[model samples]
Target: MSDSPSLRERVRTEPRPHAVALLVALGVGIGLATVHWVGLVAAGALASLAAPTVRRGVAYALGAGVVALAVFAASLGPAAAAVPGMRPVAYVAVGAGLGLPLLGSLARAAVP
Candidate 1:
């Protein structure tokens, strides 16, 4: 027989700390993202990184991507309609900006 508590018992005992951490991360992410009203993408990416769950992470990523796309399309509609070649730049910018939050969340998760 094992000496440690069962998985359910462990989860019951350790629920609050991780929940608090996740909430803190989520708050920070949402705050930063809402600052310029353009960081939703970053927030979403950070949300994914804050939680270890793959389903949650992917949902966050997709949500962020949709927000980014909408923001880009709205912000650059005129230019895009005129140039027809700046779409790639928008993609790159969104990717880079969103990547920052992901990296930040990952770093936070790495700490003890």
Candidate 2:
């Protein structure tokens, strides 16, 4: 018999880490909240490293961005109401946060 492992065996060996993805996303949210713009990029890069695949990394980034936006809105409250334009900015920030990490993961996946 051949020594090569079957596709089913490979799949069984490689289990996805959903919990870790969520935890990393939560950390990204916190980083986005406390740090400057660089924080978002950092979080994305970190998430890419933590996730097993590009798709998972993208999901993590999106989830983290949403959570961060919610925290930002909740904390700013009336201030956000005063500056409605900032709402759009926040959405853009979330998009950027997700996009950069996805790009990073994509690059990594492509190279390796």
Candidate maximizing lDDT: 2
Lowest lDDT 10-residue stretch of candidate 2 = 7-16
What is the Cα root-mean-square deviation between model 1 and the actual structure?
7.3
* lDDT, model 2: 0.57
Candidate 2 local lDDT, 1-112, one digit each (tens):
9998654334323455545544654686466647676555555555544555667666655555556567666778778776556788766866765665455444334522
TM-score of candidate 1 on Cα atoms, chains taken together: 0.41
Clashes of each: 0, 0
Per-residue accuracy of model 1 over 3-111 as CA lDDT, tens digit each: 9875433432466654664455456655666576445545654556544455556555455545555555676666757544667875676675566544444432342
Q: What stretches of model 2 exceed 4 Å from their correct place?
A: 1-25, 85-112
Instruction: Give all TM-scores, in the order shown.
Output: 0.41, 0.56
